[model samples]
Target: MGHTLSSLYPVHRRAPVYRPKAFVVDDLATLHADIRSGGLATLVSVTGSGLVATHLPLLLRESDGPFGTLLGHISLANTQWKETDSGIEALAIFTGPETYVTPNWYAAKQETGRVVPTWNYAAIHAWGRPVFFQDADRLRDLVTQLTDKFEAGFPAPWRVADAPENYIESQLKAIVGFEMRITRIEGKRKFNQNRSAEDRQGVIRGLRELGAQGDTRKTEVADLMENIESEPPAGY
Candidate 1:
């Protein structure tokens, strides 16, 4: 293999290992959109013992603030919410499509053997103070909204009202509702934006092949990369 004229200079610099903004997504709509699509989130907070985390599905209220509010309910038996302090901060992490890319997927690898394997992923972090409440009426409303949102895609969507009123009320009594008024948020969408067009195309092709082998991760990432590539160049 021989070097080309384009190889005389560095075409792309490696991104920082920590919080590189090459694909940092700051659009408020996009951030909330990802959260909606990926309903499950890991909520983390500092407890008296140390740090504790609970995984739950969160509903986003966009009009609540500049960031937004995360709503969810947990079992009353689970004292994690009770241990949460109003003065302390908490974090909620939501993740979307992610896949591993091999160095062989980059054209630059064949040219200079300089490329290395890396992971591409999309994620969002929401930080706030946890507010817990047990009002029966509010809990019913929150549970109904959560059920409606999740069931909307089903052909025969189920509703909270579908169950017996007494049963639904009893269920709500066993749980506690909480909301996190987001004070800060960070969204990252690292999908080879730092790579050259040639390398990116190579990644897209390789991902497609893996997708054909029945890998959902590969399919999702490939679709996202193709969408970015198909978009008009910035500042048209």
Candidate 2:
């Protein structure tokens, strides 16, 4: 069968989430790693008006609560924070590496002719009530921490202090910080773990071979597939 243009592309990014029992990632350490490396996340809240979503980066505090806490800020002009319902739980989604997978990689495709294409990805979801604040001191502290964490990746890392104090103070007034103490957290890594070892190996090899040609994202997916042996949580 010939692949159509649509089939050549990946499964939709907005595909409804349906995690199989085998896909549930129930480990704190692994969940936290995905949260950290996922970098930017989408914060969604339901309010009197409707649903609002903000895309931003958040700081994870593993020691803050049973699950954890998320720290981040938004522009003063962005009304999503103000419109969020405090009584309702907010959702923050962190997305890691993802790529389109083809059935051609499956050993079953050739042997049994019974395989379908799927997308492999890693993601983390955190839920909690968001508490927004505008205290200058607290905002300063939050921004400082966020700056340090992200800037550490650069050779010449910049710090909050590098900016003029007055400028920083003025800027702080133009934004508000929020804390969402995670009441629940879940991570999912769908990497064909349900497939037979032969099929899984073929997938890894196919992904890596694609990576060798230039698409490093495929390699990232392959790397996770290679480590599907990590112990799953209880009852799963």
Candidate 3:
């Protein structure tokens, strides 16, 4: 089941001048906190046959160890999981809001035509070995935890046990649960960090004009940058 693994694609050359560093989150507690807040992640795997990907709502759990495991369920009918070999490694991509940056947003556009359009986004990639769990109790626990996490804020939070036991049991059988013991984690917050102050301001203004999801995301990026700068130096 072991196969030669290829290195992940490097950050785009045109990306910011910042040196890309991989952040290994050895504390599963911290990792799970992020996963819980993020809600959804994209699962990707490589098989001898080809590549497969799926968007999933993940349930992260921590243990007293270097890395924690991720819990999720996929449709039983999905052949992708079945095709994966025993030792196959997979990647889970967690993405935050993203925005589009127009070329006109760069102040450089006024002096020269050197500027090009780019995207601003935040994401985390988790690489690990996946193990599928087909047990009924395990599946039920996963589902219950997932529901409780999402429904906690609601006045009438829905519970799996609220439904008939037979129905819940039957539904659980229709899907397969999976766990991934993460080995590597890469987090990138690709905002307009590399841009000049004027250029960054222009980009923010442009985003305000667009007023779409991208624009809102750009505003968030601006806020994050401001927060980072405003924070006092360590041990201050």
Candidate 4:
């Protein structure tokens, strides 16, 4: 896949000041790998008159060339694909665990009651052109890869081919395979990078005490924070 500014830049819109994020990812391969390992993402598309969104597992196929293709499928009964206008773009959003930060989580808040609640999270948005296909062979390949990835933990791993031939064929007919040539990718690691070191530590401790998905993500955020602290300042 070829890397170009036109393909990797985010579509900017002026609105919520809170929506602006630091665009940190500069490597396509690293960004693609993150999305691939994250496994699931929300695919959003706009039709002529409406919007359709579906949560699904996606596979990223790497190419030696400039761009990679995203592989996934949607139910045949879902008319969203057909409703979308030709050349319409789509967004696949992958969100990691996120947590709301209460003012109480900040040590600075104890001294000054000016703090407001915020959220800490990690997410990536991938934009691409959708390519839908109904070919039986392609469908089979997609199903096989999806099943294998999800079933690898089982004692007797499930295999699509293990099912009766007719059953498998019938099942494959019920879905449409699609490949998206990713044209843009934007990654945001909103883990309180804007906060002071002490305040970030306080947030991490608060999240850990909460012991939820957000807390689990805090562990990762903590690691990132450590790495940032250890690195030499840029242009030093």
Put down candidate 3 lDDT per residue, 83-158, tens digits, no spaces: 7654556788887767777888889899787898888766667777688878998999899999998999999999
Model 4 Cα shift for residue 171 (angstroms): 0.6
Model 1 compared with the native: what TM-score? 0.88
Q: Worst lDDT window (10 residues) for model 1?
A: 8-17
Question: Positional deviation of 184 in candidate 2, in angstroms?
Answer: 1.1
lDDT of 2 by residue, 180-202 (tens): 99987887888787888888898
Measured with C-alpha atoms, the lDDT of residue 231 in candidate 2 is 48
Q: Over 4 Å off in model 4, which ranges? A: 1-23, 212-236
Which one is best on TM-score? 2
- How well does model 1 score by local distance difference test? 0.84
> Native-vs-model 3 lDDT?
0.71
Taking all chains together, each candidate's TM-score versus the true structure is 0.88, 0.88, 0.77, 0.80
Query: In model 4, how large is the Cα lDDT of residue 18?
Result: 34
Cα displacement (Å) at residue 190, model 4:
0.5
The total of clashing pairs for model 2 equals 0
How do these models rank on TM-score, best leading? 2, 1, 4, 3
lDDT (10s digit) by residue, model 1, range 4-30: 323432223222225665777777887
lDDT by candidate, in order shown: 0.84, 0.84, 0.71, 0.72
Greater TM-score among 1 and 4 belongs to 1
Q: List the residue pairs that clash in candidate 4.
A: 1-65, 1-66, 1-67, 2-66, 2-67
